[model samples]
Every structure is written in structure tokens, then in C-alpha cells.
Target chain A: MPKSNLDLINDCDSFPYDTFPSQQSAFTGYYTFLLPNDARPHGLLTSATVQSMPWTSDFRIDHSTKTVHLLPASHNPADLASSCTSALSNLITKAIQTNTFPILHGKHSEPYPILGAPKGPISIERFARSLFGLTARGAHLTVYTRTVHGLSIWVPRRSPTLFTYPHCLDTTVAGGVTTGEDPFTCIVREAAEEASLPEELVRTHARSCGVLSYMGLRDEARGGGGGEQGLVTPDLIYVFDLEVGEEVRLEPGDDEVEAFYLWDVETVRRGLAEGGFKTNSAVVMVDFLMRHGVVRPETEGDYVEIAMRMHRRLPFPVSARQVL
Target chain B: MPKSNLDLINDCDSFPYDTFPSQQSAFTGYYTFLLPNDARPHGLLTSATVQSMPWTSDFRIDHSTKTVHLLPASHNPADLASSCTSALSNLITKAIQTNTFPILHGKHSEPYPILGAPKGPISIERFARSLFGLTARGAHLTVYTRTVHGLSIWVPRRSPTLFTYPHCLDTTVAGGVTTGEDPFTCIVREAAEEASLPEELVRTHARSCGVLSYMGLRDEARGGGGGEQGLVTPDLIYVFDLEVGEEVRLEPGDDEVEAFYLWDVETVRRGLAEGGFKTNSAVVMVDFLMRHGVVRPETEGDYVEIAMRMHRRLPFPVSARQVL
Candidate 1:
């Protein structure tokens, strides 16, 4: 039996935060990572990771409160950034040397921002984000063209050599939002680098269709990076829709994407139902179906629940301005 | 000073459920309305309303737990609907006759579904919905046309004589979703009845853009409806987008709207910033701007927060089936 559209959403947003008790229990035993002078938690640390990791003076783990507090070397924005970055860098190096976590082996030099952090210029290496359950922001673009029959989407298969979710179906152009880069700019850059899409074509046609936030749990079934299971993953994906002309073509520019396939609506639905697409990409496709009127209340029983779950109110702070 | 885009959103989603203590206090002292066999609350009632209303065998108000459990006349669907309808309708009639809640005076004969109720074809008169703090479902359509200066929306002004939100700007076509009516069908019907839009045009051009769910508080500042203030209003608006040609003209099919104006993007923004649009309509319009890329993260610092708040999770059940 194939999975329903709601099931696909649950595959990505698997954390149980529906009930008041469940929400309380979801983070009860986890070690909270907080900035100095802030009551709101920025990240969650598992007991196993907290026990195995080496401690530096920059971080003070209060066992009583189960909190890991970031004690900055200085309050200045640049100094805070430098101190935190060096401390995390040294920890990642030690983990790699001891072969503790294979996920750190695929670390890139790119810095991913802690989105809602109060202090300025706080970021860590891209791959090590999951170690402390911080919210990861990314941009995903769903490119489609109207055909005589219906709409067809440009889908890509991930390169098998990639470390995470390799050889799975993906959005036309998708990438992480690096530090200081907005979502739109990130998508444009990823489109050019990964899909060989023309800059002018993307800029002119792509529509910002809002965002999807979910609390994801990285378990072993997700495959790729060999890390401990049940790492709390909160994600905020900025979704974009690009309606291209039938004449336009997409080619893989790098080894990240294996190939591009232009699949019709039915094919896309079948792929989603069969669990062939990557979890988060499947969620994006489900959102596309809902937005385009392909999936509706009349046909789908879980329409309202699916829409609400896709945009779950993430527990962490999302904006530096503290509007919430 | 003009309000920023995020301020416009906060006008509708003003309830502070961001913190644990705030969420706990939001419904702490309120009376819970539950079905006989269910533990989850279907509605919330204020103590004042409970004291003034007449009670029958159908409902048992437990002062100990601040709960009003509906003891259905029978468990059958038809019987349950009849019992609830009669119980609420009689209460509404007495309230209107004695001049208790002026909101009941504006009631229509149409029935509104109790969207996640466990038993029966449960529905009640539309006006009585706020008294019990039930989730209200509606359909809103945003009609726009592309021109030389970008997108121009067809905005409507409510009739000054209307019962609620008089003389305020509204979406192109908006109305409540009556019982047994799906959102798409409701929108098509509303478009024809409210905006004089052709049935064929609406059926063909209108695209289901998705939904916006918010927890709204009905207060005195909202105006026109003479109801008790601070009514818990959880709304699920099925939003649609209709792109029409420039030649199309909209006239008032009924007295709900006085006239229609084709406001350019700047005018719409100014109207929103100046607090001209009706509260919920302004929210729907802001959603339109976000979907259309008029509001970008590059310009709005509260980008992520606005998107998340627009889709706050309702506490009660929403769908008939137990998908959640």
C-alpha cells in the first residue's frame, strides 16, 4: 500500500508535538543550549553527545538545569563570533580525530547561522548543526511548465556520491541558506551551480510561495551520514515556485545532482506516494500539490491537518528581532 | 507612522501564545465544551455566558472542572444534530429576545458545522459560534490582474450598513463556509453571489492557493458586531487566487459590498499600512503579498515570524477524521 499525502508530511515532521504533554516531554530529557542572559533555548543536546564531547571553558554545562550555556570570551559581536566558531571548530576536529561521529567527516567550511540567536554573528560548520538540535534554514525551488495535458515538474536525482540523502529525488534547485545570505539569493546561487539554470530566467519566473517549517528527527532509516539516531532536527525551508516555458531545459552542472527528469503531475504523485523522494523534498512536493489545487479537501481527507503540520510553529526563536 | 508588514499581521494574530506561561493562561479559566465520549474540548465558554444562558437536559455544566459536557439526546447522528441545534438555537433566541448578546440578532437560518466534533452531523446557527469559542471556517478569494505596473488587485469595500466590519476594505469575495459545503464549492458560490462574478469564470480561473489559520480575538475595536468582547475566534480560511483579464469588471451582486476598486500594488500596501482593510481581510491580503513575492525577507525583518504566525496551530480538533 502506498502512503497518503499526510503520511508523507509525517515522514518529515515526525516529532510528536501535538498534545501539551507530548510537547513538554519532547524536550524534557534533552540538554538545552542557551546563550548568556537568554531564557529561550537555541539548541537541544542529546545526553549521549553531551557525555562524549569534550568541554571547554567557553561552554558551561549546568547538570542541574540540563543546560549548556555559551559563555562568550567577549560581548562584542565579532569577538563572540570568533570565540564560538573556534570552540566548535576545535571540538569538531577532536571528534574527527577520535572517529566519534561520521557526520563531522563531511563538514564543509561554510558557516550556517543560528537563525534566532540574540547575539550577533553566531554560526557553526554546516555539517555539525545536527549535533546540537539547531534550526536549519534552506531554500527549495519547484520548477514546472504548463503542458497541453497539464503541469510537469523538473525533478532531479541526487548524486550517489553525496553524503546525505544521496541518489534520492530532489527539488529542481535546493541548497542551504548560508550565513548573511537571504533565501532568494541562496536559491539563485544554487540554481546556477546545481542545475545550470539561467540567472535571468530564474529571477524573472520564480515566485516566492512562502515557507514550510517542521521539527524533523534524523533516524537511521534516512540513510547517508553515519550519525547517532534520533538527533532533533528543526528545519525552515523557504519554498519557491518557478513556472518555466516548455522550451527551457535543465542540466546538472555539478556532481551533486545525478540527472534531471521532467515528470508530469501523476508521476510526481506516484513518486511521493511510493516514498521515492527524499523526505523533505517529498514534503515540498506535497505542498506544491496543495498550492496548485491538485490535492484538495474534496479528494484528500487529511487536507487541513497536512497543511497545518507542514507549517508547525517551531519551538525555537526564528528571527533575531524577537517579533514572536 | 505607517505600520510595517509584520505589524499588519500582528493586528489579526494578536494573541500571545509564544511563551509557555502565556499559552497556559490563554484558556486557563475558560469553561470547556466537550462531547460525551471525548476528552478533547470542542468549544470554550466564558463564565458570564454560562451564568446568563438557560440550561436543559442536553448539557451538563460542571462547576468543579469548568466544563460543559453535551449529553446528547441520543448517539445517532441525526438525533445528536437535532439535540445540539435545538439547545443552541433556543439559547440564541432567548438571548436575542431579552437583548443579551446583540450578535445573535444578526443570525441567519444557515447552519455552520462544528468542524472536528466526534458525534453526529453537528452544526449550529452561525451567529452563536463565537459564544462557545468554536472554530469558524470560511473561504476567501483574492482576484488580481497583471498590468504594465505589476499586479493590481480587485479590492472591495464593505457596505456601511452591514452588521460587521462596516465600511472596511475586504477581499474580492469572502463568506462563511456553511455546513456540507466544501471550500472550493463555497468560494465559487460566494464569488457569484457576492461579486457578480461569472460562474464559468470563477470555476475556470480560481486556483486553490491554500489556507490561513489564525487564532483571532473578537474585541470592541473590531466594531459593528455587538457581541461580548474577547471571544476566541479560531478561523481556517481556505484561500484562493483568481487571475482575470483586465477587461473583467466586478459589480456588487448583493449589499454586503458597496463597490469594487482596482487598487494597484502601492495603494493596497498603503491601505494595509494605514489600517483600512478589515482585520482578517488584511491578513489574507498580507498572505497574498507574501505568496506573490511583494513581501520579501530582504526588506522585512519579521519575514519568518509573520509566515509562522499566519498558520498558528489551533488547539481543538479540525478535521472530522482523527488524522492528527
Candidate 2:
């Protein structure tokens, strides 16, 4: 049987607060990763990862409390950034050399900021974020056209050769919000690089329609592959809507996307019910349907729960002011 | 100093889960109100209110556990409804006669369903919701028009003679969702009754734009009047947006609204910062601003926090399926 719409949202927001205690008992348990001078835990670490830390004057692991504290060498923003980055780099290198985690092998030079660090924003390789259970921010845009029949959306299938969620359906354009990059710029850049959309058209037409947040659990059923499973993943996605004219054409700008499909509302709904779209992308699509009056309380019995679950309150501090 | 946009949201979602424990220590702790078959608490009752309950075989107030369980007369849905409603009606009458709670004096014949009731939906008077800390559902609609300068919204000033939040600003059209009405129907009816809007126009043009749920505390600072202060008020508002042509005019259909003003975005922003809107109305307005891209991460420091707080998870179940 196909999954319900509520199931799609639950797939993305699997780890609610009620399940935390139960999950702790079932798994090896996670350690709270706290930065210096911060009262809140900014990340989570598995027991094995906490034990493998070098403790090179930059970290303090407290077994009793199940916490790993980042000990910065200096209070200065510049000094803290460099010190923290170098320590994390060393840890990732050790993990790669020892074949401890295969996910780190996909790490690139791109640094994603750990939002709301005490002294300043700290940087970590994008691929390593899930290992620490850090919050990930990204921008996703849904491009559609209003045809005579109804609204049709431009959907993309991710490249089968890609490392994560290969061959899965995705939003028209989406990319991680890299360190020092705002969501607007990130979406515009992604639109051009991933969908061959003109910068001017995207800049002029993209409507910022708010955000969707969820505490996801990475697992094989939800398209988690080539990496560790059962990792706590907190994600905040800035959502955008773009209604393009019929003259506009969307082509695969790079190899990241395999192809594009212009699916109508019924087609999209059918695909969603069959779990054809990526987890987060399915959430975005549901949100679009709600905003466009497609999915409603009159039709969907789980309307209220679905809407509330899509905007789950993340555990970490997300104030952009904390970014350096 | 004028409040920022974040303050507008914080004013509505004031009672987050973090403050629940502290609030219990400061004030007389609240008792969890549970139905006989429910595993979760569906409402909250103040200690004083719990003590004053008639307890005529319809309730089981466990002082040690700080719980008030509703003991239904029978397992039948009709029997349960009458038993619960009569018991609550008696309670409200006693409170009104003894002047135990001023809020009950404003109670009417309208019955609001207790969503997610185990046996079936049992209802209580709408005005008595706060006394029992039950969730109140409503429908709010924002009407706007396109102009040469920018977008202009139809803002309504609530009637000065009203019982609650008199003379304050509200959405273009808003009203409580009665027991048997769905949100879409409720909004259309409210649009006609509140704003004198034609039913044809609203039914044709009103777009269901999702929902906004928040855990609000009823206090004087937040425009709560004619009632007891410091009551737990959980709200779920179904939001709709209608774009009218420039030729359309909005008139106050009834005494509920004193007047209507078509204010531009800047004017609305100034009014919001000046704290001129009601608490929930302010939240709805902020959502409108966000959906329209008037507020962005580039300008607002508390952008992410503001968005997340607006959708606080209500402690009670809100499934429409639970409503008969």
C-alpha cells in the first residue's frame, strides 16, 4: 500500500521529542556536543565518535554526563574559527584513514557553519555534519507554470551517479546553504547551476514563501545510502515558489540532475503517495499543495497534524545573529 | 521602545514548554485534565479551579497526582457528550453565580468540540475553554489588493464594544470555528458576516494558505480582558488569503468591526511594531508578511526563531478525525 500524506511528513520528522528517550535506550546513545560558553547543546555525537576524539587540547569528553565540550584556545572569533576548524579536520582525517566512517569519504572542501556558536560561528565539512547531529540549512525552490488544465510543476530526478539519494525525485532547485551564504543568494546560485535557470529570471520571480523544519532520522528506507544509519539530522529548509511562463525552459544544467518532468497536481500527488519523491522534497511538495489549496482540511483528515509536524521545533539555537 | 517583529510572535507563543515547569513553581500548579480513555492530558486546570469542581460523580480529581479525569456516565457517544456537557454547564453556572471566574459570564450557547476525545467529541461552551485550558480553533482570512505602489491589505478595527480585545486591530475577517464547521466553510461564513464580503467572491477567490498554531498565555499585556489572567490558551488558526480587485470595497457588515482600512505594507509594519494589533492577529499578520517575502533573513535578526515559534507544538491532540 502507498503511504499517506501524513506518513510523508513523518518520514521527514521522524525523531520528535517523545521518541528521544526511547531511542536512547535502543541505540548506543548520543552525547550532547556543547560549545564553550554556551548553555545549550549545539550538536549530538555517538558514543563511538566521542571515544575516538583526539582530545588535542580542544575537546573535553565527560562520560558521566555524555557530553563533548569544545574547548576553544582563544575567545577571539578568528582564533576560535581556526582552532575549531583544524581540530575537526584532524578528527575527520583520522576517521577516513582508519576507515571508521565511510560518509567522511564524501567530504569536500566546502565548510558549513555551525549556527549559534557561543563566541563565533564554527565551520565543519558539510558531509561530517550528520555525524555530529548538527543542524543543516538549505534553500529549495519549486518552479511551476499555470497551464489551462491546472498547475504543473517542474520536477527533477537526481543523478543516479550522485553519492546521496541517487535517482530520487527532487525539487526544481535545491542546495545547501554554505558557510557565509544567505538563503536568497544560495537559491539563486542553485537555480542557475542545477536547473540552467537564468539568474535574472530567478532573482526577479522567486517568491520567498517561508520555511519548513524537521528533525529527521537518517535510515535506509528514507533513501539514506553510502553512509551511517540512525543518525539524528535536524534540517531547516527555506522554501521558495516560482511560477514561470510557458516560454521558459528548464534543462539539466549539470550532471547533478538526471532529467526534469512537468507533472500536474494529480501526477505529483500519485507520485508522493507512492514515495517517489525524496523525503524532504515530498514535504516541500505537500506544503505547496496546502498553500495552493490542493490539500485541505475538507479532504485530508490529517491536515492539522501534517502542517504542525512539518514545522518541528529544532533543539539547537538557530538565531542567524550568532553567525560571525 | 517599539517591539520588533519577533516580539509580535513571542507575544502570542509566550508559554513554550521550557517555561511550563517554572510557571508551576511560581503559581499554583496546573492539574492535567484527562479523559477516562486518554493516555495524554487534553487540557490543563488551575489548582483553584480544580478544587472548586462540583465532582458530582462525573470527575475524579486526584490531588496527589494533580490530575482531573472526566468520568463519563456511559461509553456511548451521545451519553458521554450529554454527561460531560451537563457537568461542565453546572460547573460554569456555579462559577458565574459565585463570581469565581468572570470569564464564564460571557459564555454563550455555542458549543466547541473537544478535539481528539476518545469515545467521541464532547463539547463545552466556547467562553469556558480557557478555564479548562482546552484548545480553541479559529479561521482567519487576509484580504489584499494589488496596486501600482505595492500590495495593500484590508485591515479591520474590532468593535470597541466587544467583550474581548475591544478596539484592537484584527485580520480582515476572523471568527471561531464552531463545532460542526470546517475551517474553509467557517472562513467563508466569517468573511460574509464580518466584512460584508459577498459569498461568491470569497468562495471563488479565497485560497487556503495552510495554518498557524501557537501556545498562547492569556494575560493583560497581550490584550486579554474581561477574564482571569494567566490562563493557558492554545490556538490553531486556519489561514486564508483572498486577493480582490481594485474595484472591490470592504465594509463592516456587523458591529463586530468598527472600521476597515486598506493599509500598505509599510503602514502595517509600523502598526505591528507599535503593538497596535491583538496577539493572535499579530501572529497571523506576521505569517502574511513572511509568505509575501516582506520579511527575510537578510533584514530580520530573529527570522528563523520567529518562524519556528509561530508553530509551537500544542500539548494536546488536534486531529480533525477526533471530531465527530
Candidate 3:
């Protein structure tokens, strides 16, 4: 049976239609989350529904100003950092208790990678990621090759005992954009750590393929924290396409990945249709198929919708006055 | 003397800060240009500013609804197509009168590649491109080679007698994204036409390296129309990085390009600093250097700003309701 576009996206992690208010709300106020690479808002944030979450206690919403204050204006960098850290620690402890320890619990020793914040070591960034309170930018590499049979994708099976969708399929190389590191640096580091590939080879072969931004209500049992309330996970993964020769092989360089396999495009499509791959990874693969012209509007009835869904609209203000 | 990032972008074409109204204005309304392959608004358009332009006679703005209707709802696609054709023909005629005929006046037989438009031929796409009224999406290929001494970029010199930016330095191969064509297919077509590279070789060597989206106001003497009003040229060029062997030699295949040269990275940077290359091409080169780690953020004070500027925020609605 031929799989439809809806079938492919059926199990993919997606935000509920009513998760975010269609219009700005007076009660919740705007400035719910931080904008990546920019300090502006294109539209007002109306996550009024999420204001009552336990992790959001540190943030104060002012109905009078219709704004979200991340600590008071009188708070210095030190005070702000302390508040963020304290809030994040409580959330992380609770999350870890239910989901087990994270596979890569990074040192909270770096300054949070805020767009316009002061630079210093702050571990709250890691906590922010677990809570999905903040949008964590990262680079994902989809390494593939063309053979006589046609195109095949290289996928990694995550370690079974680790946190976060353990035993699921992932892109060839993926990791978070840490506080001090850029997308390229992160991709290179992850390629070496997650997959035992030579640095020189990875550098030459990998190519940046824009960003895949998505907002989803992640499951608590799937290593995402915040209990059944479900954290709003806003992620921006800088997609990279790398074409390697047939001789190149990938071995699991770290414990994050359990094994590596090269699956043909047919197998990949079927996996995506059957919801076998991790939701995010499936989105990435869908993007790959669209770019390569494998999936066309004629073949996929919801082609435009699928293509447009790859990026979520982030509200960015035109002026710096909105920056808190 | 080395040039700073500001120096590099000083003369580059860009939108005026005031072109778009401040914050979803009801009087002017908001129509965001799209970030490619996504339904996100990367930037907004205030038709209030454009409503007074010479060629925008057909576009009617409804302040109450906050929408800029391309044509009256009563007008059919055929009627709208005729209006677009009439506007484009006049603009093209005026443009050609001054700068010799265009090297390649593409067939108006293709549908206007509006995201939500019907799939049929419409000549107005060319007019939209020349007027820079709506954003035009295209794919650009930056072919380079890795040598023992580091990297060298392939540059093409535009023909002195050409219509647009005559004799200016360009990427190894560059072209527009025709209505129905995807980036990969466009690149393949352009590679053969501009650089005379074999189709098979281009397919194997080229790698998709994200997109460089910028909004610029171009000059009247150049191919850009809209006269003194200076159309806001919103462009999203899908950047391709093709690594070729040191042995391959490129010859200009089409009359659009006068000559081809392979300059090392240092020479490319110096040319860019001195404004020897076209403004957009300069931006693209800077992006290439940044991704390859040839440019460091610590060394470059405007690193973050430069990276973010490559992709301007365009305003795109969630639904497919904005087709003209």
C-alpha cells in the first residue's frame, strides 16, 4: 500500500492547534520565550496556557505592561543567573527522577546562550534544554551517498539505556549548539563524538542546509521533562547535507549511539511512514526528500504544507525596546 | 588595508529601515516575505509604502483587514495575469532601452512561483523579479577547489556588454529560480549554461549549503526596475558549495558570462574588501569563509550580526491564503 503524506507525519511530534493562543492575551503577557540570533519579536507571544507550569515560577508576568519579566529590572547579571540556575535545578532534579539521568548531562559551567545576555559560565542552559523552556539551537548532519541502486541515508540508533528517546533512529550526526560554540563548530564536534569520522573528512564533506525549526509538545516518558503537562519544545536545528564516498564508514564514537546503519531511500520512506524514526529525525528526512526532488507536489498532496511545516514562525519585534 | 564587516556591507543593496510599518500596523498592515522552505515570517512588508509606487496601481490595500490584495477579488487569474504582463512589459521595455537587451529574457511561459499560486504559465514572474516588488527566490552555486595551499574560489566575470552589472565579478555560476524549478535542478541547468561544466560532474560535485536571503534596494541603471522608487529586492539565494578537483578547467559556455577565473581565498577576500565583486556575491563569500572557519567570531566583532543578516525575517502566514 502506498503511504500518504499524512501517514508519514501522523506520529511526528507536533504542537497542538490550541497549544498557543491565536492572539495575544492580556493575562499571560508576551515575551514567553527567547528568540534565537535576534532580540526582536515579529509578533506577540501568547503562551497564556503555559504560564502556570512549575518551571515558569522564575518568570513574572505583568498584566499592566503585557510583558514577561525574566527577573526584575533591578537584577544584575549575577542575580539573574542565580535565579535562572535555582529554577532550572529544581526542574532538572524532578525531570531526572522520572526519566533517569541524561546521557550527556553537559557541564552547566558555561554562560546561558541568550541572544543579548552577558557572557559567563552558567549551567542553567542545560536545565533550560531539559525543560524545553528555551529554544536550543543545534546542527544536524544528514550524511548520505548515491550508489548504483540509488540514494541511501545513514542513520544512527541511539543507546537503549540512555535518556531521550533511547533505541530510536537519529540523523547521521546531531548535537546542541552550546553557549560558546557556533553551528559549524558544534556539528564538527558532534560528528567526531557521535560518529567516529575523521575531522578532515567531516569538515570537507559536510554542507550547511539551512535550519529546521519546530515547536512540539513532547512526551514526558520520552526523556522530555515537565511531567504530563508536557514541555513546549522549541528547537532550531541547522540542517547540513554531506555526501560521502562509498568507502567512508561511520562507527559509534560515543555511548549516545548504539549502532549505525545505512538504509536505502525506500526503507527510510517506509520507516517514516510507519513512524519508526524519532519524530524530529523524520522531519529532517522529509526535508531531505523535498530538497532532492524525490517528493513533488504531484506525488504528495500536502506537499506545500509539509514543506512549510519545516520552520515555525517566531515572533520578533522590530525594535530593541522589547528586549528585557 | 583590510576591510571591516561594515566596509564590506556599506554599498551592498538593502531595504530601508522604514520601508515596513512598525509592528503589525492596522493602517499599513503586515505581509511578511517568507523564509524559504518554511511558512515562517522572516520579515514584513508594509504595502502602504509601496501602494504609491508607479507599477502598484493594481494592488489595493485594505487598512481594516490588514491585507494587501494583489488584485480585486472579482478579477480572475487571467485578468490578473494580463495586468501583471502589462506592468512587466513596460518595466522591461524601459530597462532595455537604456542598458542593451537582456542576455537571456526567460520564457514568460512559466507560472508565477508564488507559494500559494496555481501551477500555470504567467509572464508576470519576470516583471516581479525586475521590479523587485515581491521576493524572488533563486539558487546560486559557489564552486571552489581545495589545494595544498588552502582553498580557491571559482569566479565568473559578467560580460561587459551584458544588461545587468556588466563585467562585475560573480560566483562560478549563478541564476534565478524559475517558477517550477527546484534549487538542485536550477543549479544543474545553470552550471551547464554559465560554466560549461558537464552535467554529470556538476551533479556529483555540487553540495547544497543552505540559503542566503537578503533584502536590498537596487539601482535604476542596473537591471532592477521600479525607477527612482527603488524596489525592495527580497532575494533568497540557495547557496551551493561544489568542491572540484584541481585538474578541472572551466570555460564560459554562455554569453551571459564573459570569462571565468580561479582565485585563491586571499585574493577573493581582497577583491571583496575593495568592492571588486558584486555586493551580494561579496556577502555570499563572507558566509562561505565563516562556515569554513576561515573567519573567526572573536576576530570579527560583527560575526553574530553578519551571520544573522544572511537570512532576513520574512512574513509568511500559516495558511495558503496569500496567493496573488
Candidate 4:
């Protein structure tokens, strides 16, 4: 039997991350996450506190609470990104020294600003790496086709040469929401790039579903890099479902995706149980199945638990960020 | 301004009620609730502890931890109901003494058994009152009509003579799931009784969307009677949406409902802000609006908080009960 969603999130507790209040000059509602002193450190931290980092004096770390805050609350995203570029590059280089890394693709863009809504472009690599110590946001699209038999999901397999979760099953279209881009725009671009789908078809058929959020330690074994094991990953995934008819054909539009597979719900469930899909994609699929009534409380013993886990309920003010 | 969902549930914390493990003799997985010493009395308790209650020799309450337990592990729902009849009647009579109460409606049937999947019948009143200290489950239906102007929800003005939330707005149809009954059947029955809708139309139009669960103190101000304030109410509300055509008309099928109002989204939002709807129905409407794109993150500052609040995330294992 496949492990329940509750089991997957058993260790993803949020209490360990102490919170830092917004600084006097920055946006008022947003909060930043700080690793507690007792937490195991990944390679990212220079010392036990955020203030000890020698790169730039743009952050504050409270020793009493062990909380970390970005300084000069009005600091521009571009200037912040510019300041962190060398430090971020060094960290990525250190990671590559321990593992084979793939060259980054797509335009480096700014995602919705975490604290304030600002239009600024940051490298996608840095955003994913949480170089600024903020949660990252992404858009994941689940493309499915319904026939007389039942529902079948369009699954993509990552290229073997990619650095992250390569050759594993993934959602039909998934991409990080860049620093300055809207979720809808990001998903539309990804749909065309990853699946060779027309913009019109994606815009016409796509529905904005709810979101999936999670905070957890990065899986170091997956080639994210060894000393990177305890790097905190806080993500807010905006989910969408696109329905395609039998007449529509999907081919890999980019080298990042190796191939596509249309698998029935049962088959998908089995594969998910056997760990055939990427972790985030599996979470999205499980949520999709639950929402469509393909899975029910009677059939699944942990249905309530699974449903609650998808919400994540991160304490950060994600909606207050004008960027989304 | 309409109160945000977070504001509405600000004081509705899920503590004060201590958990009681299932007795060794009865079911293995079922649990019950007991009020802690510091909490206010709900008037339902015969004594400060569950052990002191005379009716069921099956229950045990530990003073040190303030934990309660049902002793007979194998006690069936029917047997449990039978054992608590007199005690439950006492609570009901006490309630009646304080306020005018309406006669309970619907078939007094047993719902899905909690621990083991067995068929049995328990009175709707007892189940709603949770005489056995089990979570009560019910189904609520939202019937709406879509036209050129926009979508209009069929809101029922509850009868002034009714005991609970008198004259307040309610869903198109809502009813408690009785023992030995299924959610679908209960909703269908409620649709016909509360709205005079044809059974065929109801069975065909109603779609099982999802569920909303909450755990809080039952309102003592309502006709459920004073001192009823502290009684813990853990509920799993199965939600459904029924689509009706413009030509269809809705009338109160019974005196439980006084009138019907077809209100557009804006009007309903105003009414919610003005405190025109019952509490639970307000939650259901907020969820429906969010799901249907009527409420967007851009327009609603508390969108994330509202969405998270709808899940409730009660600690009790609602799924352990065989009943849906």
C-alpha cells in the first residue's frame, strides 16, 4: 500500500522555525523565517546566526529569539539580488563541487516579492536556492483527459541529464514563479514550453484551483547536494488543472522534459505508492485525486489527514505580498 | 466591512476539552471529550468528571490528567445510545426548561458506525446533542441559479418560531446525518423537506463537493439553552452544491423556513457582514465563493487566512468513525 499523506509530512513541523517580525521601515505584514540555534545547519549558514554572514549588512539576527530579519525594510529586490549574486554563486559552486549540476534554463525573473509587491527580476537559481531567506513560490499544472473509461493524467518525465529529480515522473507543466511574474502568466508560459501546447488552449481550458504549501528540509539524497541536507524549503505552490479532449496532442516542447505518459488513476496511484513520481508532483496528484472524488473518506483511512496536510498553513503572510 | 473568517473564529480555539481514550473493552480507535477543570460548565455534565456520571458505568475519568475514557471497548453505538437515553433526556429537559425548542425532524436512523462498519439507528436529537460524546456529522446543500445577470444563491430565511438562529439565513437545505443513514440520502431528504424541491431534481442536481469540520464551544445564547455554552461540538459537515434553472421556484416546504431570498454575491456579502446568516452557513458560503472564483486573493486581504480557517484542522480523528 502507498504511504498516506500524513506519513509523508510527519517531520515537516513548522514550530522549529522562529519568526522575525517585519522591520520598522519595510512592509508591515510579512514575516521572515529564521533557523533556530538548535536546528542542524546546512552548508548555507556561515554561523549559527544570520547576522554573522560576511556578505552584506542587510540583515539582522536577534540572539535572544534567534530570529532573522532583512534590514532597511525598503531595500530594493534588484540591489538585494545584486549584493547576493557572488555569495549565491559561491554556494552553488560549492554544491556543484560535490555533485554534477545542470545548466539553468529559462529567463531569470523576479517572483512575487515576499514582503512587498515590487517588479524586479532575480535569477531563478537564486530564488530556488532561497538566497534571500524567503519562501519560494511556483505554479504547477495538472493536465488530464477524461474519456468514457475514466480520468487519465498527463505525466511528464524529466530529462535524464537534468540535475534535480531527473528521469522521474512530474506534472504535465511545472515552473517556478519568477520574482516579478504573475502565477497565471507563469503557468501559461510553462504549459507552452514544457508540453508544446498552444497558448489559446491553455488559457481556454485551465482553471485556477487552490494552492499547496509545504515547509521541509531539502532531500539531500536527490542530488540537491550533500551538505545541503538541512536547507529549509518553504514553498507555496499555486495549482491549476487543465482538461484536454482526446483530439489534443502533447509533445515535449523543451529538452527538460524527456517524454509524456497518459496513465489511468489506478496506475498513477500505484506508481505514487512505489515512489515513481517526483515528491511535489505526487503531492499535487494526491490532491487532484481527492478533489475529483476519485478518492473518498470511506476508501482512504487517512482522508482527513491528507486533506489537511495540503493546506500547510504557513504563518507567513503570503497573500499580503503584492507580487502574487 | 464584512468580518474576515479569521476574525469570526478568533475566540473559537480548539482547546479546553481534554481527550478521553477509548476503553479497553469497547472499540480500539474511538475517543471522547471531557471538559478540563478550569473551563466553564456546559450544563451537559452530571458531574465535574465523566466517571461520576451515574448512567454509564462504562466511562472512566482520570483526575490527574483530566482525561475521560469509555470503559467498554466493545460497546456498540446502539447499546451506547440506549445506555445514555435517560441521561440525554435529562439534558434535553433542562434545555427545554430554559428556552422554546423545535421538534427534531428527519428519520431517527443510525449513521455509519464509527469504529466498525455496522448498521444501526440512533435518534437525530441524541446524535446532534452528541449524548455519547461522539462527533456529529451532517450534510448541507447550497442550491443556486445562474442567469445572464450573474449567479444568485437560494438563501432560506429560517422561521422566526424556530429555536436555533431564528429568522437568520440558512443554506438551501441542511440536516444532520442520522444513524444508519448516508450523506446522500440525508441531503436528498432535507432538500425535499426544507425547500419543497422535487426528489428527482435534487438527486440529479446535487453534487458532493467536500466537507467542513470544526470543533468549538456550542453557543449558549441560542435556544439550545443557556449553560449549553461550554459543550464541545465537533462536527463534520458534508457540503453539496445543487444547480437550479431560472424557471424553477423555491418555497419553504415546512415551517422551519420562513421565506426564500435569491441574493447575488454582493448582497450576500453585505448580509454576511451585517450578521444576517447563521454562523456555520456563513462559513459554507465563504468557502463556496472562494472555490467559485467569487472571492479572489487580490480583492480579499484575508484570503489565505479565510481559506485556512475553513479547514478547521480539529485534532480529533473524524475519519475513525465509520459514519460519513
Residue-level lDDT tens digits of model 1 in A1-324: 999998898889987764622244567778888876667787888888888777766789888989888885544654666677677777776776677777777445578988777766578877778888889999999999999999999999999998677888998899999988889999998999999998887888889988899998878886647668777889999999999889988999999999999999999999888888988999999889889989877788788888888998887888767734
**Alpha-carbon deviation at A318 in model 3, angstroms:** 16
| Clash number for candidate 4 | 20
Give stretches of model 1 more than 4 Å off: A18-24, A74-78, A106-109, B18-23, B74-78, B106-109
How many Å off is the CA of A148 in candidate 2? 2.1
Order by DockQ, highest first: 1, 2, 4, 3
Candidate that scores best on DockQ: 1
TM-score between candidate 1 chain A and the true chain A = 0.94
**Tens digits of per-residue lDDT for model 4, A1-324:** 566555444333221322111113221212233221112121122132233233234345555544444333334545754433333444444434543222222223233344222222323254334433356677888999998888898988899998668898888899887656766788999999989999998887787766677665544454453343334556677778898998877899999999998989988887777777777777878777766666655467666656655665554445433211
Regions of candidate 2 where Cα sits further than 4 Å from its true position: A19-28, A74-78, A106-109, A220-223, A320-324, B19-28, B74-78, B106-109, B220-223, B320-324
What is candidate 3's CAPRI-style docking category based on DockQ? incorrect
TM-score between model 2 and native: 0.94
Q: What does the lDDT read for residue B234 in candidate 3? A: 61
Candidate order by decreasing lDDT: 1, 2, 3, 4
Per-residue lDDT of model 2, residues B95-173, tens digit only: 6667666666644558888877766567888878887889889999999999999899999999999977788888999
Candidate 4, residue B287: CA error in Å? 1.5
True contacts kept of each: 0.62, 0.66, 0.00, 0.14
Give the Å error, residue A43, model 2. 0.9
lDDT of 4 by residue, B1-324 (tens): 657655454333332322111113211222243222212111122122243233344445555543454333344555654443333444444444443222222223233333221222323254335433345667888999988887899999999998668999888899987666767789899899989999999887677666666665545443453342335555667778888898888999999999998989888888777778877788778767766657754466666655555665554444434111
Total clashing residue pairs per candidate?
A: 0, 0, 19, 20
The whole-model C-alpha lDDT of candidate 3 against the native structure comes to 0.59
DockQ for all candidate structures vs. native = 0.60, 0.53, 0.09, 0.17
Give me the runs in candidate 4 sitting further than 4 Å from their true place: A1-57, A60-64, A72-112, A115-134, A150-152, A219-226, A262-264, A319-324, B4-58, B72-134, B145-150, B197-205, B218-224, B244-248, B261-263, B321-324
